[model samples]
Target: MANIEQAATYYEVKKAEDVSRLISKYAGQGKTNKVIWLALIGVFIDAYDLTTLSFGIEQVITEFSLSPVMTGVVASAIICGTIAGNILGGWLTDKIGRYRVFMADMVLFVIAAIVAGLAPNVWVLIIARFIMGISVGIDLPVAMSYLTEFSRFNGRSNKAARLAAWCPMWYAASSVCFAVVLFLYFLLPEEYANWLWRVSLIFGAVPALLIIFIRGKYLTESPIWLANQGNLKEAVKILNESYNIPALTKIEYAQAVQIKPSHTGFAVLFNKTYLPRMIVSIVIHISVAFQYTTIAFFLPSILSRFFHTDTLTTISTTLGLNLLFAFTGGLLGVYIASRLTSRLVLIAGFAIQFLALLSLSLIGQPENSFLLYIAIIMLGLWLFAEGFGPGAQMMIYPTMAYPASIRGVGVGFNRAVSGVAQATALFLLPIWMAKYNTHVFLIISVFAIVPILVIGFLIKFEPTAVDVDAVVENDNIIKNLQHQISSQ
Candidate 1:
């Protein structure tokens, strides 16, 4: 054992590092990137399937004779279901296994997509979308955990930096959804327009189904998670497959021996160590979801209303701008996140959102063509901040906010908070926008920003990739808990 330990130390100093130490080091390299890349497909599906409805919703409303309220419900149905999925799926991932959640969620996605594609009525479509939301809810926390863990294995200090892949992928998926809508709209005859929306909605299943097939071969248990379960052998295999590192020490397994293998309920979040993080995660996610979902999903319709443009022009411009600015925003968020603190990035993002919303309220219905151009410019700036800040960070923050012990639960809770915000936003946005004008609606969005700004500045901590144990020395809350545990 002594000789083996010495050899491991030698390898760490010069040759292949031990698997445990190097997991975060090799992120986005050979096998680690492959796993993360596969995991991102789940995020892509979630973003695409969930956001596509907004682009095609005008068509759905026309087809089903949906009132604004009904449209809101239909729009938010998946989010509502996702709220449940996030809670349940996170628990299951923490309790059962990551791979199991991955497999099960996609199956739900496939079935839900089929129902959505063939729905005979609005209620059926709502039910189908709700089911789809559940799948997304389950898929995200698990997939995000995989992505973060592998990226940490790549050896990046701040784990949130790895999430750069997440935002761009999300924007790309939304862009694809719009592109599909535009394609089907043009290809099909005027009489068959409803099919355009249906086909575009169902397109979510394709990538999901393909990724599902890949899970058995490419996907495996998260080594970080397995180590948590005290399964050294299985964890070692996964670590080797992920980064091609040598066998690891029994550090994780030995420590985990003391951990009870059961669900740590919501009560865990209330402990001194986790409380602030939980608060930050929940607030940032909800605020971002409310702002983005309401804005991004309704942009086309809002444009149609604002400029009084024809349907074709509105749809074309909507898709084009969402692609251009949103894609840019995603990239910016990633770049900024890698360099800046999360709190700083988040503050900047919300500030931009607030300014943009305030500007739109003030500019209400440009009197001339010049002001119209200005409104468009303001809209672009708002989106750019969104992509650079919340749009990108929402995914990153959830993964970073909690330790591996309850990552799934932590992220799921974030997702659940997001779902509540999403459902309320989706349900109320259209009705309120229609009731008051777009001007009032834009101003109302400012409300989400104030709280986010207050919270972002108060929380001074950031998440590192390793684990909670690694974080305890710096945080008084975690330190106190550690002291308590030792005393006990």
Candidate 2:
């Protein structure tokens, strides 16, 4: 009996090894390029739709006779809805699966786009935008989590960054939309102005339609999620199909031991083991959220106020900068993120943004075009820093830090909080910019400072090149070592 039990244990351990080897062998092949591309395209479409409204604001305001306050409310509605969507989508994805949730969200996005385009009044438009926001909001966190989980660590991180890199397509598409709006504005007589804006809103549906086909045909569910659910057979099958490996038998599947789920919750984030990292992530996200809304969404309005450029020029320049310069920032961030720790990159990025904002606040005054130009360039650089640094930081950190069981929830909570911060900033920044002007930069400067302090002093866990799972284990070892040293 003892001999039989010992043989059984040996067989189980060997089986687990064989299964791991088989999975890694296929994962090593890195054949997920096409899937990653399709996912990136999906993200691009979502980003484009979300950002397009910023460009359409002038048109919407003109046609609807909307006050600045009303415009802010309209913009804020989508963001608020997105917060709810993130939580709901995350829960659904964890409960159901990533592919199912993604497909459903795509349909929602398309329907919302139609409603928004056809909205007859401001109230209707606001409701449609809110729904649209929810759809995209759910899409971002889930899509990102799917990409990270499906990707193998070898060059997969870079590929994941590229998935986000395509986010500029959002700005590029918005730029084109701006161009189209400009053309229609000129081509059509004054009587058709309202129709022109409505057309642009309707046109937002194009990306969604394209993505629906792409996602339906190609998107694969996350194998990690499958493994965590104890569906080794399905997980292995996906690996075989995605990475082109030989099929495994039920016997092989039974040999694999179950992976215990990580106990992830909102409360877990505040636990002693995780609190510091959580704080750092929150501060970085908040700073990025605040700056992104102020710069990306509000910059054109601010530029128009300061430069007194024509509507076309303002829109064109805004589109151009976002597509060209902002995209550059995203790429630059990926490159930098590969070279350094996410925390370090985040720290440096925020530090640069702080200086840039301080310089702008000091020199940015009415009638100072030269300083304004400098400020714009610096602002782009600031965006580049965040785009390259904290952007990757947040995406990689949460995905890696949390356990498989609560990974979706952890990401959802982070996104929800970030969304709230962004929504508040989006609604208020414009009003503040119109009213406070220089004081706005001052406020941004203060927010930027918070992350630098958090990273430098408080953050103890640094997962630079470590696998996210390994990072959690290593963090435990570090804690034990610290305790021993202190006691000694």
Candidate 3:
């Protein structure tokens, strides 16, 4: 009887320690800076792959002898594929795990890039581009989920900083790609122009390859995920290695075993407690979708229409502006987002975008050089605001609002919605711009204003600069506890 009692006591103590370690790991206090950087590298590659087509579109058209409408269709194809991929990827991330999804997606992107470069006809190019879009679409949600989950172990504020730094790396890569393409075009003969475009397509694969190796070398499964799976021992082990915590024994595990909120599906997002925030998140995403498609995707054509410049000059100028504004805005957005409320940053971004659009609409008539410069500067400011605000806001919202269990789904839903908006805008905006000119900008400006008011005035939650775990715990326990008790 004495021996049996002693064994039973030992088991109980061991179990308790296991639980304690699990909690610590899931709470995100144990991850290293190196883990964060590797994840960011994956995101950088994802961004580069997504933006590469914008620079390659002109060359694609000339090589294929395709019409402007066809070019729009090609661009729209990727966005459409991305929408589908985002939903699938989000589901898969939760189902399969982040590392698996991330690594696989990179391979898909690399394959798509190589195929796109080798395409013999326009249809093949379209197919390849669509596939590439799908891969990036998957990467965005999975990568963001990975970043959010891992960073949470450290702090949400750190996550914001990491995203701010890494997200703009995409724009920087796009700029570099454009410069390289231009140089290659100049260096190579017209007979080899198609080859240069092909080479550019293949270049999209490089970052993915680099990230794949890095991820393979260093990436670990999310500890939060491990806890959710009831694998406390493994979760604790990861925490020890990641955060430099000493090994936890069973006694610690039992003391720390508290049930966290479930975060697995669409239901988590639509739960009564999270519903209003969900609406706010959806609106923010839609607003960004509208703004991004109009400014980033359509700006070149708009310039061409207004300036009556040759295609090369229009593309070159647009690429230059994209590089400048995207980089500046990305960096600025990171800074402001880290310092201010995401809601305020978003409102400010829309306000800036609206003003820039209005200014461009009023002054951007044909052959108006002074107006052109004004438009460029204002647009740059607008992009800057987007980078600091919407870009960062998008990264923050789903992660902040959802618990770990359902975070992937929430982010995936948000990304998928944004992708749909982008696809639709790309398909329809060209026709509208051709018909209405400045009126198109005016219409987009009006849409941008509505969200600013709704988010600024109606929404009550503020997520900026808060402790991520504390916020999640408070939001989950206090707000949700109240919600549960009230519902009963």
In order, the Cα lDDT scores of the candidates are 0.74, 0.68, 0.69
Query: Lowest lDDT 10-mer window, candidate 3?
Result: 1-10
Question: Which has the higher lDDT value, candidate number 2 or candidate number 3?
Answer: 3
Against the true structure, what is every candidate's RMSD?
4.2, 4.8, 5.6
lDDT of 1 by residue, 113-196 (tens): 988988999989988988998999998889888877776522342357557568878878888888888888889998887797
Ranked by TM-score, the better of candidates 1 and 3 is 1
RMSD of candidate 3 to the true fold? 5.6
Which prediction has the highest TM-score against the true structure? 1
Estimate the lDDT of model 2: 0.68
- Residue 264's lDDT within candidate 1 is 41
TM-scores, each model vs. reference = 0.89, 0.86, 0.86
- Clashing pairs in model 2, backbone N/Cα/C closer than 3 A: 333-388
Error of 2 at 158 (Å): 4.1
TM-score of 3: 0.86
Which residue runs of candidate 1 sit more than 4 Å off their true CA positions? 1-20, 153-158, 248-259, 464-488
TM-score of 2: 0.86
